[model samples]
Target: YMHRPAFVALLVVLIIGGTSVGTSAKKAYNYRMRERDVGKSDIVWNNDEYVLLKNGDINKAYKKIEDELGIKALKISVVPLEMKYDRLEIREGIATIKFLFNGQLLCFIQAKNDIASSNNVVSDRKVNSEIYNIWLDKQITIERNKLSDDQIEYSMYLSINGAYYYLYGIMEEKEFEDIVSELRF
Candidate 1:
């Protein structure tokens, strides 16, 4: 009869663990919904897969990065106005993030939040942003590689706020120039 109590205890433990996992998952879902709603923009989240956005409201994505890094994150000023996406995903790395706008691959941004981990590559091309960002390295440099007929990949090295940021993306020439030139705080 004493063995029966041990079996009951085991069952209780399993039940409790399952309930705890369910509760935490629910909490995460609720929190994501709240944050999405608070944006008050046209960002639509059907599930955890991808966030479909017509207006391209990226507040949640950039805000999350900033909150985690404790530093301001970069935002794209010039965006494709005709974009209509249906899925959303945030692929994360050690200190990197690649986000899809609802369904399409937008860009890849890696924030080297560590000062010592900054990229040491010498500036290949002079980068001048009339707009000054405090977090930007004064001697920021950039390089470009043509990936395909239509896709041009650009990598911009930024040393800022005692950290470094590597911005990488493949876009049209005009789009890339507009993004790099129009970057703001």
Candidate 2:
């Protein structure tokens, strides 16, 4: 009789443990599927002057920024601003998203402005290095400055009708260039 009770208890414990494991596995699988669906979606904002393009995983993007910068106060918020040409009203200021790829830190900035006004804002004066071409034959002016004995900062500026973008980070030179090449800007 005692053996029978012990056996029943073991079976009950096994059943409960199996149910818990299965539930956890299912939850993980669902989370991955959700992430995949988000990655396949496109987020865009279009107007007469320009279009802003972003991935559907905006929350994930913000999370990346928080993780990379170790900042907890950053929240997704819109700022109102006035543009120079056409008196274009900007409802958003800038979006800063960071990601880590192949052990490199990449920061992406997305902003929108009138094409006419954006043209006037492009200047190579701040860039410390020679200009190079990237996506769509667009010129990328780079500036690198030493921040400390072991660290360096890089800034890349590019303007397109879709958006006015800036990427700045402290990383390896080759990795920075690689990330710039992948930008959709």
Candidate 3:
């Protein structure tokens, strides 16, 4: 009975304090790692575009995209317009680019193939024609479709090249056009 209540209170305080300190240290370490990762990329925060790709070579960038997306023979180029993006991630045949402004989602870009055939409809006639054109080395098809309200989808089907690329996101019509205008190849 030597100050039993006091000893119990002290023990509780020590446990709580240790837990908080550990949590804080972990958070700080994660923040440092994120900063380091961002530094390794070819992005300068003060620049016009948030993601300024190194060397500005679309073909090289496309290879990176292909590896990330697990796709084969992806031959295309894109030059993004001036815009701020929060982060970009590519994993499991998908590339996601997220744009944020003041901690709010402005828009995003998702690039992937129609692997599940859920969004696209393909017929025998279309396949036969595509094959013929590919044999002739004229199998490049670029199409743009406007989805329901503030959403647009741009597709570039490279039959001969054996890859299909799509860009779709929720953004202003004018802004979307600006981005589409920058696409090359």
Candidate 4:
């Protein structure tokens, strides 16, 4: 009787140990999958609030973003803004969106008048190029002056991802810093 009891107890210990190991492995797998899913679904930048010219289809992305934000289709006429450095094609109006973090977001949608036309069809390449150039010039300036150096003089830095989509216009360093600071994400 004593021997049998001991044998049963030993068997129970081995079973419990095996079950514990299996459960631990299963838990680990579950945790890893959850983390991966979160990473895959991460939203890096805002589309509607910010002027995002993504690598994907610009019109499709713009439409979807516009609908999501409940914003109307932006009809713009480009206005030539004479700056100290160069003449820039500025969007006639500025759209302000109250974003999280007590921050105000400013989006400039180029007006039709501001953009030059070749044959009445708006040239996307031209627009993209103009924006990109402007973004680059601004980035260089921002890099030269660190944020800690002057908070008042801080210029917005254009999101690198956004700049990639519109790579044509000349950007002042001050403008790039200003844009980057405005971005929430």
Candidate 1, lDDT over the whole model: 0.53
- The order of the candidates by lDDT, greatest first, is 1, 2, 3, 4
Write down the TM-score for model 3: 0.34
The best candidate in terms of lDDT? 1
- Per-residue lDDT value at 150 in model 1: 47
Ranking by TM-score: 1, 2, 3, 4
Against the hidden reference, what TM-scores do the models get? 0.48, 0.42, 0.34, 0.20
Better of 3 and 4 by TM-score: 3
lDDT of 3 by residue, 1-185 (tens): 87999999999999999999999877654521112135456332322332344324433445566566555523222333433445556755555455543333433233554556443534221111111122234443434455566344443333324344444344454444444444443
Q: RMSD for each model, in Å, please?
A: 17.9, 13.8, 16.5, 15.6
Index of the highest-TM-score prediction: 1
Local distance difference test, each candidate = 0.53, 0.50, 0.44, 0.32
Better lDDT candidate (1, 4): 1
Better of 1 and 4 by TM-score: 1
Candidate 4 residue 59 Cα shift, in angstroms, is 25
Error of 3 at 96 (Å): 2.0
